[model samples]
Target: MKRRDLVIAALIVGGLVLASAVAVARLAGDPVGLLTRDAAASAGLPPYTGVISTFTVMVWFAAGTLSAFIAWTDGKHRRRLAPFAYLLLALAADDALLLHESVGPRLGIHELLIYAVYGLGALRIAYLMLGEERIVALAFWTGAALLAISVLVDVAFLGAYLLEDGAKLLGVLVWSTVPLLAHSAPRAAVPVLGLDRALEHRSQPG
Candidate 1:
C-alpha cells in the first residue's frame, strides 16, 4: 500500500480506538464488553438470534467500503459515488447500532421520522445515480423496490418477521452489488452545475 493510504488507515484506527476508550470510560463498562462483545452475548441471548442481522450489517459495511474506495480513486464519478458511499455507510451504522429502533425512540424521535430521513437520503442517491450505467442503476432500483416492500410489510403487518426481514435481506444483497457493477463499468462524464462552463470561461485569455 502507498504511504498515504497506510497513514489514512492508521489515523482511522487510532480515532476509533480513542473514541471507544472515551465511550467506555464515560459509560463505566468493560471495554471488551462494550466494544467487542456481540449483541447476543451482551443480552444473554442465543448466538443464532443475531446471525442474520450481523450478516446484513457486514454486507452493508462491505458495500460502503467498496463505494468509498471507488470514490477515492475514481475522480470522474467521485461526486456521485462519494455521496453513495456516505449513504451506505450511514445505513450500515444505523442497522448495526439499531439507531432507528432503540436510540431514536429513546431520544423521543418517531420511527416514521427516521424512516422518512432514510427515504429522503435514498431519493437523493437515486438522483445522483442518474445518467450512470443502466445496469448499475437497475440493480439499485431493484434493491430499493425490495426495501420498499420490506418497509411496507413492517408498517402494515408488523408481525410478519419472515416476510419483512426476508425482503430486507434480499434488498441488502442486491444493493451490495452496486459498487462492484459501478467499478467494472466504463466511466462516463457527469456534468456538474455550471462548474465546467465557469472553468472554460476562466481559461480564455482576456
Candidate 2:
C-alpha cells in the first residue's frame, strides 16, 4: 500500500482503539458515569457492542464496494467476484439495518434465512478461493469457519450477551481478512481469467 493509504489506515485503527477503550471504561462500572450506560441509553448510543458492530458494518460495506468495483473494472474473474461482492454488500446492509431480525421473524424464517445467506456465502467464497495458493485458501477457509462459529456463539450464548457479541465481533474481524488478502493478489493469477488474456492481447502488438 501507498504511504497515504498506510497513514489513513493507522489513523482509523487508532480512532477505533480509542473508541473501544472509552466504551470499555464506561461499561466497567465506572462510578463517574462518564460515557455511562445510562448516558448511552439516553443519547441513543450503542456503547461497546455498538461500536464494534458499527466498525464491522463499515468494513464489510467498504469491502463490498471495492470488490464490486474490481469486478466491474478488472479483466479477470469478474463473474466470480460478483457473488462475493454482492454477499458482502448484503451482509453490511443486514448489519446496519437488522434486516433479517425485522423481516425474518415476521415471516417465521429468521434462522433459516440467516443460515442460508451465511452458509452459501462461505461456500461460494471457498469455491472461489480454490484457485488461490494453498496457504491463502486455508486462511480464507479458517476465517469462514470462525464466522460460522461466531454465529453459533451468538445463538448459543444469548444469556451472555457480552460474550455472544464479542465472539461475533471476533469472527467479523477474522472474516475481514479474506477480501483484503484477495485484493492483494495479482489479477493475472486468478484461475478464471483466461478470457482476460484475449482482451489484454487485443490492446498490444506482437
Candidate 3:
C-alpha cells in the first residue's frame, strides 16, 4: 500500500481505538470519566458533549484530508474541481474554528446564515458537477439532505447534542465517501446496484 493509505489506515484504527476507550470509560466511571468530566467542567459543557465534539473534530479532519487528496489528484486534470476542493477545506476550517457556533453569535449573526453559506457552497459544487459524475451528484445531494436534517434537529430541539452531532457526522461521512466512490469505479463512477444500471443491463443483448 501507499504511504498515504497507510496513514489513513492508522488514523482510522486510532480513532476506533480511542472511541472504544471512551466507551469503556463511560461504562466504568473511572479515570476516563473523571478526566472527561473535568475537561467538560473546564470547558463549561457536558462530558459527552466534549467527547462528541472530539469525535466530530476527528471526522472533520478525516474529511478534510480526503478532500485535499482528491483535489490534489483530480484537480490537476479538472481545474474547475479546484473550487470544490477549496470548499471542502473551508468546511474543515469552519468546523475546526467553530465559526458558526462562536463567531456567528459574537457578530450578531444567526446559525441560519452559516447554513446559507454552506448551502450556497453545496449548490456551487452541484453546478460544477453537472453532466459529470452522476453518482457523485447523488452523493452530494444525499449529504446535503442529511446535513439539513442535522441543522433542523439542532435548531428545533434542546439537549439533543449527541443526536445532532451524530447526524452531522453521518452527513460528513456521506460527503467524504463521494470522492472515494467516484474514483473507485472508473467506468460507471458508482456502485453497480442502482436501477439505472439495471435498466441498462436489461436492455443489453443476450
Candidate 4:
C-alpha cells in the first residue's frame, strides 16, 4: 500500500476512537434518556433532549461508512461493489433518520426503519465478504445472519401474539449485531491495510 493508504487507515481508525470516546462521554448516564423522553410524553410533555452527541452517534456511522468504503474501493478495483456501495449509502442515510426517542417496546417508525436499513446493509456486506476467507467470513456471516433474522422477526413476525416474544429479541439483536457486523468488513481489509498486494505479488520469489 502507498504511504497515503496507511494514513487513510490510521485516520479512519482514529475517527473510530474519537467517535467512541464521544459516545462514552456524552451517553454516560443517558441510557435512560430515551426512556425518559417517552415517560415524559405519557404525561403530555415535550421530550427532554440532550446535547447532540455527534461522536456517540457518528462513531457508528463512521464505522459503517468506512467498512462500506473499503469494500467498495477494493471491490471496484479488484472485486462488483455497486450493491455494497448502495447499502453503505443506505446505512449512512438511516443514521441520519435516528430519533433517539423513548418508546414502548422499541416500537417506533424511526427505530424500526433505522434498524431495518442497518440490518439490510449488514447482510449485503456480509454476503459480499463471504468468500474472503474462512474464519473472517464465518464471523461476518454470523453477525449478518443474526441481524437479518432479528429484523425479520420484528418486522414480519411482529403482531399481537408474537409481540411479546418476537420484538424483544429482534430489537435486542439488531443493536447488538450491528457493531459486530460493521467491524467485519474492515477486518477483512487487514491484509491490504499495509502491503500493496499488487507489489507484494510481483516481488515474491518465483
| Residue 132 lDDT in candidate 1 | 59
Ranking by lDDT: 1, 3, 2, 4
lDDT, residue 121, candidate 2: 76
lDDT of 2 at 190: 47
Q: What TM value does model 1 have?
A: 0.80
Supply the TM-score for candidate 4: 0.35
- The whole-model C-alpha lDDT of candidate 3 against the native structure comes to 0.69
lDDT per residue (tens digit) for residues 53-156 in model 1:
78888988898888898889877456667888888888899989889889999999987898899899889777666645677777888999998898889888
| Best model per lDDT | 1
TM-score of each: 0.80, 0.61, 0.62, 0.35
Local distance difference test scores for all models: 0.80, 0.66, 0.69, 0.47
Which prediction has more favorable TM-score, 3 or 4? 3
The C-alpha stretches of model 1 lying farther than 4 A from their native spots are 1-32, 187-206
Better of 2 and 4 by lDDT: 2
lDDT of 3 at 96: 65
Candidate 3's C-alpha runs over 4 A off are: 1-49, 76-81, 187-206
> What is the per-residue lDDT of model 3 for residues 1-206, given as tens digits with 9 covering 90 to 100?
68799799999999986787788787887666553445667668766756766666677667657766766777321432456557666777777668888888899998889888888988876655543456776786788788777788878986787678778888887877766765563664443234334544553599
Better candidate by lDDT, 3 or 4:
3
